[model samples]
Target: MQLTQFTDLGLRVVMYLAAAAPDSSPSTKRVAEQLQLSYAHTTKVVARLSELGVVTTRRGRGGGLTITELGRGASVGWLTRQLEGDGEVVACEGDKPCPLREGCSLRGALRRAQESFYAALDSVTVADLTRAPTRTVLLDLTRPAV
Candidate 1:
């Protein structure tokens, strides 16, 4: 399954923070520059992650974002849930009534698939994502070639 841009950017921001110098907290500007993304998008992503308790932000002197312990153990499923914005799939939105309301096998199948997908993802942690070789390479210069 394809991750939404929010999830992708959120992950990048978290990984960047996780890999920064132990005593150096990166400003959003630095993170955006390093990741080659817009500052506005980086700020937005950082805010959302903070709201979700995945990352903490400190302001004023030595201010910046830091991944929380919650963030350290965060799972892909958690990110997916947050990005989903209401934990829904298909015509599950309360907006318009689905024509198939009660008897849609497709909806059931899709829901099942989504559940399975999340369940599988739940088994993984942000640490797992952080340790991923490809992502590690982008976040750290000290990463060894594989």
Candidate 2:
């Protein structure tokens, strides 16, 4: 299954946060700039992530965005599910429904394939994504004066 760009960005945001100091709490603009992403789009992503309880936002001084413990420990598969929603792998029914929807084996196969894809990621936590090579890269990317 192809994950949406939104889900990709959400994962990037979570991974970046997981790599950061707990108290750093960089602002959205800072994150957007550091990540080389659009501020407006990043804002929307951050809002959704906040709603999902993976990120927390604070206003005024000494406040920005922080990843919750849930965000840190969550499996990539679980987080992806939250970001992806409960949409089916294939749209069997719609205004223009698939002709083979009535008895299609494809839909079930696709669903199972999607599940397997997610299952493969279940072993990796968000924190694990930032470890070693990726950890060093992310740390360099997030450093000030970058």
Give the per-residue lDDT of model 1 (tens digit) for 1-146.
55678778888887777665556667888788878888998999999999999888899888987788888788878777786565446755477888777776887787788888888988887777766675557566423235
Cα shift from native, residue 3, model 2 (Å)? 0.9
Q: How accurate is candidate 1 locally (lDDT)?
A: 0.76
- Per-candidate TM-score against the hidden true structure: 0.80, 0.94
Model 2, which residues run further than 4 Å from truth? Answer: none
- Per residue, candidate 2 scores C-alpha lDDT tens digits across 1-146 of 68998898899999888898755889999999989888998999999999989999999998899999988999999999888988998888989999999888998898899899999999999988989989998988677663
* lDDT agreement with native, every candidate: 0.76, 0.90
